[model samples]
Target: MEQPWDYLRHNDPAAAGILDALANDRTLEDIDRARILTAVDHAAHDLEIRQRLTAELTTLGSAAALHPSGLRTLPGTRFATHNMLAGQVRLGRVVPTANSALMRAGDFGIDHDVLRTSLMVIGPPGSGKTRSLAIPIVEHLALASLAGKASLVVIDPKGTDFAYDDWFDITIDPLNPTHGFSLFGGATNADTAADRLTAALLPPNVSDDKAYFKDASYNALYDCLAPYHAAYGAWPTVKELLALLRASQSVHDQVKAALKGTPGAKEWKEHLDNRVRQSQGSHDPAASLVERLARLDRPALRKIFDHQHRFEMRDINRPVRVRVAIPEADYPEASRVLARLVVSQFVQTASAPDTNRRIFKGLVIDEAGRYVDDYVARGVQKVRSNNAGIVLLTQTLADFPPDVRPTIFGSTGCKAVFGGVDPETADHFSRWFGDEWITQNTVSRGQTSSITYDDRTIFTRRSGHSEGHTQSVSSRRVERARWTPSDIITAVPPGHALMALATSDGNRVGPMLVNLRN
Candidate 1:
């Protein structure tokens, strides 16, 4: 009770664990042992949980469970929701393959440390990516959240995959009417909220040839949002923002009158002038972004956008777990918009100065391809250092633009490839896995012909012909992909995946096979 070791010494099972530790001839340093003890003690005051921690600490040392996963345990099968006490979750064990050695058939576990580096899992449908990887990790994080160590947000496009209602404090389902997400994702800064929404609402190619249009769209939204927030102290309603985006004459008149001689009034008037000027052209640059927003303003979604009670991204660092289920089937484009908005808002809020450093934050997007724009890809590297991590699940590498693929892949330190991935995607993984040196054998064979007239030289025409055969074996060093495209595409078992992991401190493993079945 007073001292953890003293408590452990009195526990017969835990005492047996100590004896086992002594038998191993290895031990953790005093500081590490103390840290583990303190984490365990703080996470649970239950006598039984403490005894469990004592046994685990004595047996596994530094790798022991840090604490109980949650206040209570739950049953699990294809997806596991237990054994997260160590601040880590076991994914699967490494497997040996024809092209690689099993350095160790160790289990792949991810905790806040590994997650701080972010993870990108790419595989086709029915590849066990969702069941084996996402579900386990999300389940672990949720349990960790209940232990008061993490905050989690799961964006479920299908609206059912991550529906553990009891585990999540917030279930954002628009169809339910009782739950929703903030229109601006609870952004504190007006311009930041404007920018995030602008990024999401615009087309993917807005930042391509006509980059000015992207800038204009951002500026256009900011002009209306800043003054409105300065006046009303809140984000504008979806209808109000829509009217502003369309540059309607009546809305501008009402806004101009409302802000006459107010702060930023002159700038607001100038932006209105430019908006009117832009609207006069045969083609308005803001048309594309407006079209996207109109999709959200429809009867199917406007209420949720304007929902009074909703979860905000700014509150994610408060030991909360939220599951946002988007109705992608009925509103495909709107769902993507919502997903993109969540990504943008998360990046902004998590990177802010006031974000809680002690609470680990995680975002798991079941199908993240459509939501990943240039902004999201670039922001991945920024948030990892801020105690936030994201798990991106994609069906194919082709979902990302060719130019941004490297940025996305490079930013995420942890990567996984499931069985049956396309050759091109496998090739990408193959190249990323790099090359290793191995001994290659070469067998050489040759035939020789010769003529002799030795013994019967005097007999003028006496001659002989001889033929000889020779063989030799030689070995040389050569470099080959650790996991070639062919091997990556074919060798991975049906219920396994290829994984590579890197911790926050630069520790890395894999380009190895992992058996997911077990």
Candidate 2:
């Protein structure tokens, strides 16, 4: 009787060699024979050395290049066994030691570089963008302090969105937030202070020829009005402010027109002149207008013209604390304005130290796409020059302006993409890793046994062949990713996402399932 090895010898001499080698030490339960088998099996399928080399380079190839198809295969679903094992080892006790910033410096995978760039986390509403991005930033900041690195200044939308008062010595005052140790000076209220500082810090106009009033009027209006709206809970009507301006100018013009048109204009002027004499020349048209505005209780003039305050800044060395406006009322405009102001302040204040190499700081903005305008976008673009990092959180790709999108995406360097429901957004992101479209053709064989009608006697044979094709989107790249909350653990439906670190050499490292803390 022939042993199982006889069939191997006839069909695969290479497999027989490895099996014979293992037989000498039958007690050995080693993978050496399996490795040899796998290699041989793979090599046998490729007729030319080209397919084998391609497979080696891409880390994937099929047996019998034509058994599958004559078509050439690209690098897809490729992985480095050595790096994955290394990453598994480095990921030891990551969850337990995840509270504060923890730095592990070693080769996480093959040719893998350390993560030196800032990471941006983006997700839709209720998708936990705050947990994924802000928490990581806080953790990194906490860990950096231990490493003798700089701290973090998070520009949160609300004063209470993030809870780190006990974790790190943080100061939060939505009404009175300041960078370093600066506060609003010469301001009666929080709104006035924020307005004053915004006006003072940002450039008044785009050019020298333009008046600051004309050029920065909208921003100025935002600066002045945002605080009042945030504090008093109302938006100063734009139409109303415009109406007041027009009314003031109109009143002056009307008085001039009335004097010119009236036959008794000289008499009226004499009457006003007599009144001025009665008040000892104290009465004037400007005074009269002021009295009228005061009596009418115009909030527009009160917010801007009445509030002239100076913003306060603390020391450059102090830990940056952002006091976000309260979210008591739905303040979208206030949110946008305040977000821009805080971002500008963080960049200017922290950047100088970074340029001097004194210390590094990080600015974290959650839901950034909602608030970012041309002004905020420009500020975000310049953050790197200040020697600081920025993390912008958004859900949709369309959240950002087209021109600013590339810069924001490129600057992020590291991106943590959570699950997205929007297929367009998903497809857009899928392209970054270079997804390959796979098309497959299938052939089916069926068997039928039956006797024909009259003369076809007993013998029956079954035979049938059928074919079909299929197409799919499969990523050639395999990455190490942690299971995110968006992926699972919320009692919600599951989502498909692969976490990866895009190394400096442009290789992805994971699909490592990570857990998002509830």
Candidate 1, RMSD to the unseen true structure: 9.9
Per-residue C-alpha lDDT of model 1 across residues 1-518, encoded as one tens digit per residue: 14444444544556545535543444543323434544555535567766666666667655555323333323344266245446778877777665556467666667788898899999999988998899888887776776557789989988888876466777877676566678787877777787778877776554466998888777777767776666567888888888877877888787778777688778767776777777678977777777888888876577677877877889887767788888877888888888888888888788888887777899998878778877788888888888999999999988887777888899999999987899889999999999887666544344422222221111213125434556555566767788889888778888898888998889998777888877
* Count of clashing pairs, candidate 1: 3
C-alpha TM-scores of all predictions: 0.78, 0.44
Residue-pair clashes per prediction, in order, are: 3, 23
Candidate 1 accuracy as lDDT:
0.75
lDDT of each: 0.75, 0.41
Q: For candidate 2, which ten residues in a row score worst on lDDT?
A: 92-101
Model 2's alpha-carbon lDDT is 0.41
What is residue 321's positional error in candidate 1, in angstroms? Answer: 1.4
List per-candidate RMSD values in Å.
9.9, 24.6
Model 2: per-residue Cα lDDT over 1-518, one tens digit each: 44344444664555455456554765542222232233344444554543353343233322212211122211222111222211111221112211111323223221113232345566667776575435545544433322223445565665566654433444433334332222232234434444534443334324556443332333333333333333334333333333332334453233435456545555544433433343343433223322332432333223322333322332324333333433324544434444555565555554443343333456667767655545445555454544456667777767876766766666555565556435555555455534322222222223434332122233455456424433222223323212323332232222212234554334544433333432
Number of the top candidate by lDDT?
1
Q: Which runs of model 2 end up more than 4 angstroms from their true locations?
A: 1-116, 146-148, 168-170, 175-332, 350-358, 374-382, 385-387, 436-497, 500-513
Candidate 2 lDDT score at position 236:
31
